[model samples]
Target: MSRALRAPMPDLFLGLISGTSADGIDAAIVRFEDGAGRLRADLRLGRTYPWPEDLRTQLVALGQQAAPLTLDDLGELDSRIAEGFAQAANRVLAEAGLTAADIAAIGSHGQTLRHRPQGRHGDGRHGFTLQLGDPSRIAERTGIRTVADFRRRDVAAGGHGAPLLPALHAALLHAPGEDRAVLNLGGIANLTLLPADGAAVRGFDTGPANGLMDAWCLRHTGQPFDRGGALASSGRIDPTLLARLRAAPWFALPPPKSSGRDQFHLDWVETALTGHEAPADVQATLLALSATTIADALRATQPSTVRLIACGGGVHNPALMAAVADALPGIAVVSSAAHGLDPDHVEAMGFAWLARQTVLGLPGNLPSVTGAAGPRVLGGIYPA
Candidate 1:
């Protein structure tokens, strides 16, 4: 077959993400190409920008359950986030020996404010998920076409509008010869398991990840996060509290489920505490809860003999990693970097690869993962 007649390689695309953690924004530039039933990526550049303290507080409040903020706040914050994202994208472009015009487009997974996937809300309306980063502004500021707002359409098609990264995980991390589980410990922990023989892929959220523990630390210690999880490592894990936390209904839900700050944030932790525990102990218990639940979900989702590779901000937490290693004996725990990908940049690169899929008119979401009706082209494009 002629080279043109065979699969084609995708050009460079940028991805911007401000996750549910609301701590900062990530910008990544990725080069993607078809490589024998999956896509290969060369992560050219990546950077992160911490959210301004005031904006961070406002965004956290905006995302909190039932917290009311005016339209002005939302609109202004959207612009601010877009500007930060644009600057980060430019930084990546400069580092990668490229410019905005040299790339195809950007794929942005805007900051998620709310994610309600059951098709009903407290007021009895259909399910809706909202992510607030202005794609128009990014496109205009960066002078590149942009593909963004990638989840609503899936929700419209009857999916959870989350755990969308599984599509990219399958494309990039699927070990064709072995069964493997890919876990991302972001604000919430989610896992994607690709059968070694490429039989099937199953994934979902494993309750909370760093969101609760981080929030607890910030509340008590005034730290944006538990640096190296030092606080958690110092305190002791309370098995009794960990048991009670694992009893939440979310843990029992089967695969194809998803969660966010809505279900795993401050309120959830507060409910779990009930004013009976010390803050330090609570932080340690929260860490245990994250590690144990993720391990439990992996066991439930995959058969025995599966290799486990973990990524996301939570992977840096030694306490959490140790706990996970302890919970799943003999399961090889490694970073996505072992597969030639950056742990912190995986999600951002996922969006970039997704944008390449969109530009080529390909399916960007995995129906098996998101539980959408079927494969559908994801994201809307905004031209510079």
Candidate 2:
């Protein structure tokens, strides 16, 4: 049970997270070994466990509900969500033929119930980003040290505390003398720019990615997501709707801004749907919205080369991918898989690396990408 007898920290680490969509939990068991004086990480195995439909609905509502939830209600939801995270961690361990003792630590990004990344955030601030998965519960249940609350530490240090995977993006994917952009189209879309000349990295959310499209799909089709962009492919894009949706201030805002369900919810979509448009057409327009915003963000980054590699659930959507490719003429759009990484598991793998960083007293946040005042070690440890 002591550190002296346990497996070496570099042997393995586990990462668990559920994105803004509240759709499911992504779990990855990663192998890290010393490679030429640097720790090398390879994702050994990963899987996604969807949130129960009912609980998913509750968390979605609680995320941006104007109606306040009681303290007891909030507490109960937090515990339940942590229990779900624990379940996913246990499942990943079993699938990978590993035990808690085999892992040095488990990094959990948790479920973001509300992420207020700006405006007086920290321990005493009224508004602060909150991720709800009790690390204590995770450590207790998994019998492994858990590193979580990775965001607030950065936020407290005057950072956006989001899109943290860019550190791993630079680590795993960055190539010398090659300008590349990594885009993650989760519930929200964010862009990370890696310059060929080793310039400071820049990244920010590009507005609604799958979040709006998924919401619209759920409302119209009763499915959680529009599988493979079929709905969009079947429908026509409404230009007027597209213009209205893009008019939001977030698009024009410079780098370092982040958004969540609060900025791109169904109510916002309803407001955008002023005229009578076919539901499917709106879906098509939403897809276009994601593509256009992502394209625009990459354009703003304006790397020496327009080589863009995309990751996340959105990468699975053919229509969206096509739209993005079409938006950026002459640029080759590729999946992260081409670079030896599964799109769905990149974020989870990043957190596993982050956990290792925390355990070893290394800095995990990128000040250039996060807009943090400076680089600082992130996350608090919850030991088993």
Candidate 3:
């Protein structure tokens, strides 16, 4: 860790993302400063702009592989998502009293529609991931330079191209003498391991975080998500159902792995159901599956990790957080807020950091984490 010093005039970057949940577009205006081998990110403002219901519905359906999509459908969805992202960027800029001129670049993670890092044959070759929200469209609409399509480069380099936030996690939250792990509990949960001895940082997806739970909650309760995880908290965890979920072959796979709604959607959960359990109990079991998988991955990979800093929307769920805490007996589990990072916007902020890296021609993906051939600059830049 570099000594904290007064930062000079910082660069402002806007980050936009809509995770697998497709709930909304998270827009973060982040101010970054680099000095003394230290990089700092201070959130100027962060907001989640709701997606138009029809578009969001289409996104959810397509993401879950529940809806068929033609090439025209793909093109239309891509343009619509880019328009949505541009709208969100403009709205956040207005709210922050800034304009495109004030921002160095907009980093759009886009909406991931499919992620198959191991390919359809379970082999490492021919893997690809898709994130829709065109950088060209974003730049054209916002009049700001944009960096998008950050994942495919790593996939092309024989990497998972998921869990790309570990580089940013290490920069912002890594402590010198503390073996800490950063867990991003988005639609999927991913863990970034930062060792005290400065070993290579490693991270990988641990499976469903909020994606399955949110989908299940919406299907059964008509609510988009389990508010405060109240529905889950009111139910009992079905041990049998949890065992079936935990038996997934993906969980047994080693590091350099990733998954998304395409792999762990409502259908996946439904297949594991015994047909005798209540909807609430199923919800409870899904929550348990997330907690246990996260804990199991951590224990298997980095047993010495004493602190777990969690971020993403799942951090707001008291039930999920408590469940994770219960699963990890000795680990100090806490939200990223404990370390001065907003739990909701950590990922959005990470894209901001990634954009800065791309603008500076620096490598963004950690080869150890992604299993890339070597350090490679990720993403393409679109001029305003």
lDDT of 1 by residue, 1-384 (tens): 998797544378898998878888888887776766677788888888787888788777665664676799779878988888888888878877887667889999988888887755533258788888899999998999999988988888888887888878887788767788898989989989888787767778888888888788888999978989889878887788788788987789786788888777787666666686777788889988988888888887685646788888988888888888888998888888888888998989989888987888988777788888988888899988
lDDT of each candidate versus the true structure: 0.83, 0.85, 0.92
Ranking by TM-score: 3, 2, 1
Highest lDDT against the true fold, candidate: 3
Whichever of 1 and 2 has more lDDT, that candidate is 2
Deviation (Å) of 204 in candidate 2: 1.4
The most accurate candidate by TM-score is 3
Expressed as tens digits, the lDDT of each residue in 1-384 for candidate 2 is 988997545468899989888889999999877666444678889999988887898877765454477889778788888899999999989998888788889999988877777654424355478888889998988998999999988888888888788888877777776788898989999988888788887778889889888888888999989998989898999998899989987789887878898778888888877658888899999999999988887877673656889999999999999999999988889999998899999889888889988998999988887788898788999989
- In model 2, residue pairs whose N, Cα or C atoms come closer than 3 Å (at least 3 residues apart or on different chains), thus clashing, are none
Superposed Cα RMSD, model 1: 3.3
State every prediction's TM-score relative to the real structure.
Answer: 0.94, 0.95, 0.96
